[model samples]
Target: MENSHASPGLLKQANSSALHRALREKGAATRAQLAAATGVSVTTVRALLEEMLRDGEVERTGLGASSGGRRAAQYSLRRDKYYGAAVCITDGQAHGLLVDVHGEIVRAVPLKAGADGLRTPVLAFLDGLFAQRDIRSIGLGLPGVVREGCFWHADKEGGLHSVAVEPALSRRYGVPVVLENDVNAAAIGFARCYETEFPGEDPAETNMAYLHFDRGCVSAGFVAGGRVIRGCGHFAGELGLVPTADGRLLDECLNDPQDGREYTARVLEAAVWVCGILNPRYIALGGPALRRECIGPVNDGLSALLPGPMCPELLYTADIWGDYQIGMAWLTAEKIFHMVQIIKK
Candidate 1:
């Protein structure tokens, strides 16, 4: 929980995260802008930024654009000095990535996961990927529901609980890890990308839903106020369990591939279902089944379903389709950094 009166240490960590987020937005920020963006006082921002500067967390850039008065000093993170490792472990494939502080993909490598539909190989494979990277922090995106900082999945033992996947894996590498739902990670990426596309102060535009459709489907994350909507136990976007007569959920779609017509019908049905309930601005589609060719008919049908209300534009790029593993790796890196910050205190 975040408190207005946080402990000194928590306050510093929170401010650091705030500073990082602000810097990421335009790759540079002035003290006043950072203060206004984070709701932190200018004095506090200077103190915290100075502390970060001393620790090599932020670097001073040239002067900002001239306002009415003297130009303020600008600052940006030293992306090269810091690296983040991420693992996006979907139901089908696993991907690892090394990202700079800017959240841009630097190194993207794919990994084969669960060839026999088992957990041991996937687990071992993930460990090896991290070993090769020798990263300081890790972020992991899983295919299942994550609750109370814990995630539940299928293992040798059926229905195994795994929240501290990073910690468990960290036991081997001795680093911090943050295991998150893949949908949540995708949502984060979508939110960031969208925010980059459309700059804003109001939170409504940032508040939207992202759905990743594959064999067994998943909705990664939802954002309001430019922050992930993490429900208690972090199960905010687990739309899989939404009650339905046909049992059509994210995971169910991913695991069961059908004929093109059947797949199109089922997905259109899903679009109608989501439209009735969510009515989001735009729907982001990912996973294996959401290819450019695959979504056209469904798009036409869904467009026909609604006239005045703009049918949410669909986004199905290769990055969302084939590069999920890399996205996962980026996610893991984010988690690891967060965990390190928490534990170092």
Candidate 2:
């Protein structure tokens, strides 16, 4: 039998993808550097780079420093080769972002909508974005359980349940769609940001978590090995359903707190639960409803309950939606890159 593992075409595409990923992460690289980074031979890297340069997927960005003799030519992704659309629904508004291959926002717009049902408003937002620029792929951060291109379940008041969000959007727009839980998207955004800030540290090796409270519900997301840990039912982050110590539901205590102290205690309970399980390097408290002041108390409470080594760094961010957009942009961009064809002429 012939070697049926991968055709020559498929192997070439895989090598091209590896080069694309290396250039995307490194910003720019010489042929030799790309070969070393992607584990492709220098001769193959040179040929692929030539094809990418001809196709306008990459551009020459001058030359690299000389190791001994002549300097090698450096190439980088053509940031404007394609655009991706990203949206996050929260606070009675739909936020849309037009991003480049590097996941940098080119434009941003907001539209007001019903918090309970955001499908229509989100579509309107994307319509506006498409009018401004062509979009190759879309990523959505929704407040519910999503599975296999469908919004399977949502909170009691949420109106997106039972909606085939991914297929509908993809069919209408003629692009790939990625639907992720709002908290999971935020968790990914945080981890990617940490990886960018601390170079040489792989996010896939780093464990992180994000806990959010908003819209009368609490959700948490865990990112182990750079991937979201969605449970068997895609309900892993539904922290609201957990039972509280006072014989009440966790969300019930959190939503109907009698005072600030009570609210802090409730949030602490959830945070401690996360610590005991994942023991992430960082725990970010976010969402429109999360108070900035609660971060300190939550951090202190976590330290008090857990020993020094088990405690993770606690922080709060007012820009959860921004993080959501970043996560969505990167997700959509990945699909777009995979679909981009590099024809060798």
Candidate 3:
């Protein structure tokens, strides 16, 4: 999995990013642990740790438990060393958050969509957030297909199509900007939230799919080995255009409760298709219509549609909006620490 577009210099920074991510994931680790976790030499890990300590990126947390001989010095990320901003653009509103290096949201606010479009309000919100802290990067989660910083096919009224999102923001802020599809961003956030809530579980090792049904449109985000699959054209999860039974579009059935059985059945069919294609360990559903009451029926319907061997656990994410925010924060942090450059299409 090599990024052909990444420069050698950026790739070098990726090593430090790898070590940083390992430290973040483990919370605290010895040099040996970090080397093993990141597959880097211990000497290199020590050098990087030294640099990080000097730069305030990481600190010596404490001493590890004795392992028969010497107790190694434990290192952890300096969560307050830097901050990042995230903006999630939806149909009716744009939401923003100020996040720390530890992936914690320090502040959050909502900007309602207006005639001027999302760019103005989002930029204003980020400008205010950046004024208060040392923001290294910004991540924007647009409700559309984002390819190389350009946003397209956004919500009908969102007025975000073929817009140069990354360049505009990056130029304005003089920092790297990352643009991601909203659902995919939510999936990344969802996976991180799950990992934090269940530290014992390694979400990075499992295949997961996040299915979000919003306002009659169904989109999906697939994660395997902790990376989102954006596909060749960055359009991996555009399921709304998929046709349902009775020859109607999938979105057409979203509003009709009378068509609940067929609608859910179609959704299950899609889930089964995803299971066969991706063999995911779990499938998480979100959106206002996919309420708590619908979980049981959806599960039962999925069980009926899928064979025992093909069944994947069905779960619901109530706060996908929050997940999107967290995903943007994580992406922003990655851009800052990893020196991820914005690719032009």
Candidate 4:
């Protein structure tokens, strides 16, 4: 199926991408180390490193420890070569961070939103960052249903209802813009952190559901096969809309629990739905209402409803804001790298 004429170019691009990714993971490495990691010949690795250095995409850090003879030159992705701006709109505030190609935060810009909506604060924050750094792409995380990079639906209290955030941002910044649901972003962030903590496990085995209960409402985000499982129409994690047994919405029962027992029952119902369908490896429970005492009962209730193998480990995730920002940074960096690969093509 391979075309002999085009194979060489495609192979070169693939090898180049592998080298860059290895550097991103290793921070800096010599030609021989890169070749060994990427399974590319030493001569080909040297040529690609020279090309990247000439293009200013990579830089020489210094000489590495000599293995047998002379010290090999070390190479790394240029820290200032590309930047991605990740912004999260929540609680009448816009939090933004300037992330580099290595997924490190270059700068953080947090601002209070105005009455006009998140648009004002988001624009002002981005304008300030763009004035100083050349941002390659933008990632926006919103608490709502996002369909094809558009904010389709949110509670009327949220000012960003029915707004097309992605294209509007792309037009203003003249770069790729990604819009993702807040919970979904948090799920990806949780998965990444989990993998980092337990590096021995295969990342592809990361399947999880992150549930957030706040202000009398609950929603969920799912990650399967190391990717966010945004189903058709992008309404996959809208758990609050799911109905309950007594002919009322799930949020209705959650909004008005009589006692701690009833509250635990309501949460158990939600977990049952998540386990019965997704059967993820973990169900990360978080938000304001999630208490340490309630997790035990929720887990016990889930086990009673499903078989041992079907039940997922329930984890309490604090610091939703932190997870959201990390997720946005990861996504923005991925977009920038994808753009670089497209340019090569």
Candidate 5:
């Protein structure tokens, strides 16, 4: 009898998980829409939605356009019910933002110097933000590599090398913490921004790459089939390490921009190599050195390097910083949702 009951319970949990994920990906949906999206019966979807409504996890947000007789009710995750904290650590400063479940920033604190210095201010900011609300998870975007939520290295001295960042923060805050490379976070954020900006275009089904050129050095982050490719050791996109024909590193040539044509040539050379390798749907140019003036030359160089049919669209991401923070927030929200699923199981 207990085993018989357990089978149904497990089925219900699976259906619930499917429904929750559908709602999350779609942002908001009607009961019928959720049913179709999840491939679950309307009856089951309604039951799960009711449970979510009662738990304050879901809320009705007006009505959808009438498909036939009457307008259907729309449901959305309760944006204010939960929040996440996002921190981006750079060479000298850490930037933090408080984001709601809907991936909107509620508050942003001033930048602080050093990881240790960032701890006090960021924690205090989160403490104040969580004073009246619940923060589900925290995500940190470091300037260097991360593995299994552990800090590896950063560009600057006195970085995350010696600290057990994720565990320490998770223990301190009593919530899950995710650590990722800053460029990777920016790539995730860029994907989110693309989805938001172009609702009709699905980034999940596409291949995209974000190339970050910072202080003459370059690194790349790739997204294939909606997932970030971190590679075996989480060092997938270390493009800067690739040397040039002259036996000099890519960064060496990029740093010495005395000759405009030479600078353009080097940039184009790297871009061409990336295109040949990934053949991505699009490549976004980011980081400090990708200025407005450089775009024209880069485009010209690209035009000369590859034929029109083989060339991928090149775009300059102007909001890498903002996107990095938002990506961290989205990652934190995903962690929270996964935790909820685990608890239910």
Candidate 6:
């Protein structure tokens, strides 16, 4: 039988890309190991590595252990060659961070969103950033709906909605800007966590969801087949609008004393609806709700609300203090650097 982890010529360009991706994750890898991992010919792998090294993308790692032969020079990726700036805005507060390729925050600044200074502060901030440190691109996540680089939202009707925000920020920053719903950005971070953990696996093999309950509003993102589908206008996973018996959402139903009961019921009903449509493998919940000590109430609520076939166990990781702050920064950086612009290539 043919070796599954093997390939023919496999196009010079494809081999180069595969080698770069592997280098990004493994830090250092030998030519033989790279060939085994990438299913490309050893000659092709060496050529790709040489190309990247010449382009300042990869570098030699001094030297490594010798095995009955001349000590071969080890090699690794040169991640320091690039860095990104990420900004996340929620309610009326905007925070910025400098993120490296490894997703570490090198610098961070918080700016209060204002009626007049929102644009100027950010513009000055970006200009000053060039003076302080190096940044290759910019990534931003907005609290509300985004269109043409601006924030806007509405109910079923167009009367109650937010205005747009992308153009102003894009102009201020100059670097390539990508605007995504804050909730969706959080979800992107969560999905990225899974991706990093299971590098070699096809992430599309499993489904994961993240529910973030922020101060004013609650939102969620659903991941299926390894990608976050942000529907038209970059708004896809809005858990707040899940239907209800009296035409109200779970969030909106929290009016009277007994609203939690109805809200729980509606959420459960919605879960079944989701299960019917997607049949997810795992459903993980994050955000503020998980802060509650005993999320048994949430699990019980979801269990009671969903049907047998649709009821997936609820798992919570309320460790958002670190995850949220870093996730926001990483999402912003990843969105700017590793997102469509880089990935599609």
TM-score on alpha carbons, each prediction: 0.72, 0.89, 0.86, 0.86, 0.88, 0.74
lDDT of 6 at 45: 83
Better model by lDDT: candidate 2 vs candidate 5: 2
Best by lDDT: 4
lDDT of 3 at 244: 73
lDDT of 1 by residue, 1-345 (tens): 233446677778777777676676568989999999887789999998898899887899999999789999998887766666766666666666676776677776666645465256545654665566545666667777776546777677666656555446668666666667777777666655665577763434465567665544445466655566777766666555554446655457545756787667666666666666666666676665564565888888888987657477766645663344444544543543441123332
> Per TM-score, what order, best first?
2, 5, 3, 4, 6, 1
Given candidate 3, what's the lDDT at residue 159?
62
In terms of lDDT, model 5 sits at 0.79
Q: In model 3, where is the ten-residue run with the lowest total lDDT?
A: 336-345
Comparing 2 with 6 on lDDT, the higher-scoring candidate is 2
Best by TM-score: 2
Worst 10 residues of 1 by lDDT: 336-345
List, in order, the clash count of every candidate structure.
33, 0, 0, 0, 0, 11
RMSD of each: 5.4, 4.3, 4.1, 4.0, 4.1, 6.1
Q: How do the residues 142-260 of candidate 2 rate in per-residue lDDT, one tens digit apiece?
A: 77788888877645686546778888898889987889887788888877777888898785687888888886788888987777899887889888999988989887887774688
TM-score of predicted model 2?
A: 0.89
Give the CA lDDT, 0 to 100, for residue 111 in model 1: 65
Candidates' C-alpha lDDT: 0.65, 0.81, 0.80, 0.82, 0.79, 0.63
> What's the CA error at residue 2 for candidate 6, in Å?
32
Tell me how far the alpha carbon of residue 338 in candidate 3 is from the true structure, in angstroms, after superposition.
Answer: 3.1
lDDT of 6 by residue, 1-345 (tens): 011232343344456656655665566778877888778798878877788788876789876577888776677866676667777766566777777765677877897655685666666677777676556677776767676766776677655565545565556556666666676666656656666776765655647666665543456777778666667766666766665678877566533335455545554555555566666655556665433433456667656666776666566656443444466665454433332111221
Sort the candidates on lDDT, descending order.
Answer: 4, 2, 3, 5, 1, 6
Native-structure RMSD, model 2: 4.3
State candidate 6's TM-score: 0.74
Alpha-carbon runs more than 4 Å astray in model 1:
1-17, 112-136, 155-164, 170-175, 199-204, 207-209, 216-263, 290-294, 321-345
